[model samples]
Target: MQNDIPVAVIISDNAEKEEDDKLPEHKKIVADWLTEEKRRYGSSLEKREREIIREFKEDPSGVRILIVVDKLLTGFDAPRNTFLYLAKQLRDHNLLQAIARVNRLFDGDEQHEAKVNGFIIDYSKNAKNLRDAMALFSNYDPEDIDRALLNTGEKIAELERIYQQLHGIFNTVRNRKDNEEYIRLLEEDVVKREIFYELVNKFIRQFSACGMIHDFARKFGEKKLARYQRELKKFVELKKIQKIKNAEEVDFSKYKDQIRRILDKYVSSEYVIELSEPLCLSETEAFNEFIEKAENGLSIKSKAEAIAAQTRRTISEQYHKDPEFYGKFSKKIEDLITQLKAARQEDLKALLDTAHDFQTQVQNYEDSDIPGELKGRKVYHPFYRSIVSIFSHYSVTSENICLVVTSLYDIIEKNKIVDWAGNIEVQRKVNLEMEDYLFDVVKEQKSIPLTIEEIESIMSSFWNLAVRNR
Candidate 1:
């Protein structure tokens, strides 16, 4: 017996109303256990219950089992809660709700097991026949209920099928065992990679569910399952790299523990590198070191992807403030990636050099031509950049653009109240005033005739920058 597992026992409460305070025998047992547990932590009963629930939801070692009868059968959702021990009879909605407690898909992370399927250990003998227990669902047909609960054997079979399908996608790889080969193969074929990833995810889910049932692993063969786990871990690592390079957000909170476990079992410490946090482009040394480490650790294509993704993120953050400067780098990075992909003969050294060169360009952009005084004005800088970019193309001089932008910036800043972005009426009034200033004062004074479309475009750009930066 695993006594180390944390458990919450939900027994029947005899008290029907707030005035009635009678307790049942099972409730007393549960209460005594809670009291003993609380003494160790030095918390009150109410405080302890809250802690238990929190731990059950978050910390893996905190709570292992929740023994519930009536309470938490519905309206309670804890994705990490993997098992339920049923000691009381349940019917209809009650049974459906109770079983659903463990059905949540959980990603395995550092602290807990990846929840595959909710398990029920029935001691009440009320759910002996699956159909009989579910027959009370008058609203749903028998086929619907059957679809919800697949037997262990059926789930195992599905897992095996998916595993095979995943391998079949990688048949083009000359060396299936080579991690680099698999990475290259996946990078080249977008459709195949997508299918492989989807199939493997499906396989992991089914495999995890089947793992809870006794003799299921034996029936599937432990050797084969271990092989799948090993291959899955490799694919997951490659997937992470791909995601990072593509600037895709990967949420690993639920599955981090499970992924860590797989890597610990199969991969060496030298190979186990956690994804680096978002790098600050301003910190030249740190950013360079990040790129260097990535170059050393990853394939050329992977390194290129990571650099491009990070550069894109940097541009996205600073683009509004210095659109002209950052926008150029954004286009440059995009072109570099496109050129790299189109190259027939891949040169690792050349790719690495080009990526570093791009990083250098991004870092050195502060030296770009922008008036020194306007650089310090954070809020107004974006409007100035927008004005410079829009008007500089025509007869409008830099000196005149700066003067008009400065005045407009002052007028907008003064009128912008607290939460002005949320107030549409204020925005409308501000827009009208800015348009009047642009056309009446600036346009007439500078003798720069503008079309309605051009005026609207410039105003729209300036207004958006102001609101977003605000």
Candidate 2:
């Protein structure tokens, strides 16, 4: 074993000679071999050679294989460890757990191929019939025993079927040559996009499994398998682009190498597309360039969506600063997208021009009629909008409404302490004071009488807005 592969053997020391003497002849021989092997390895005879096994498990560069009997099978997990030689007869959960030691998914650090699956060399012929071994768990479910393992051919067939299903979902798209057609088709129906995602995940899992099985290329012909892999890469790139355009999170570092393998082998280097870095919304020139590049690369529909998504994200982040201004932009962008989709604009150049114009408008937004007193005050903006929303129905002058709302805003701001929303006593006091001011002062001075229910409703809206913007 040492000549061909780096190997270590682990077994019980059975150091007590009198206790060893009482054991069976076979057991005594095994114990003696363990003791001699430990001496040969020049390891200290402390803790029954546990330290040596620990070193062996940790340092994969030094030890390529480990031979063990009745130890280190359970309570051991090493992602880099693959391949097990099972000589001992293990049954039930013991057998399942033993094989699982090597079944863990492992991605190689810069130097090695990933450990996709564990291989078992069954010298004792315990796993010759996997079904019989798994049959022991029939109490769990008899049918589950067969589902525990799938041969290479079955996995390949399932992958092919899933790939076909993905293509079938996009059958309405007539032009397969244009990549944008694929994106547009998916964008038109959210359900189809979701199904595509689900199928792609299933396909990837099976593709990774196929890497571990022997003679996969032969079972699933080399040319056909290569085509599937190339298509899978394309789908993955599309998904990445969609995620980025929507401001969705894209973290694939764990599966990066596995994906790279498919691209490196089957896909052409020149044809491979990488996801662009995230857009910096604060930089005007950089942002415009990003949108221009997106226009050139993606379809008209996708370009519109990408711009709209970024605009929406910007509005969400800056809404607290200027609620009324950003609110209008949000509504305008949403309306524009609805119109574009309804028209089905196919002229890419026209679409890009329209999108750029909208992007410019969003960047250069200015509030027209905001009172000069509330211009730079962030906290008062939401209060102003809330007031306009509530009192616009009544026949009252804008000046008088602003004056009364400003007073109400001042009262709420003064009483708000740490977590005032959560404090019932604080809320009760604030609500009563607001009611008194609105009914007594505003009703008498402004000649605008409000009912009890109206006062309560206005107070609720004011406090809620204050809490959100505070």
Q: What's the distance in Å from true for residue 73, model 2?
A: 5.7
lDDT (Cα, tens digit) per residue for candidate 2, span 420-443: 878888888888888889988887
TM-score of each: 0.70, 0.65
Backbone collisions counted per model? 10, 0
Candidate 1, residue 451: the lDDT equals: 69
TM-score of 1: 0.70
Clashing pairs in 2: none
lDDT, candidate 1, equals 0.66
Question: On residues 1-470, what C-alpha lDDT tens digit does candidate 1 reach at each position?
Answer: 26676666544443333232356776566566655665875764455556767877877666666655556666788887766777777766777787877778766654455666677777776454456656655555777655665477777778778877877887877975565677677778889878876675565566656666777767878687678777776666556555555555544444554444444566654444343133344565654464446433456666676677677777787676667778878888888788777665557558767766776766554534567666665555567767675676677766777787787777678788888877888778878988998899877877777768778877787778777777
- Cα lDDT listed for each candidate: 0.66, 0.67
Give the per-residue Cα lDDT of candidate 1 at 432: 90
Cα error, residue 82 of model 2, in Å, equals: 9.0
How big is the positional error of residue 353 in model 2, measured in Å on the Cα after superposition? 6.0
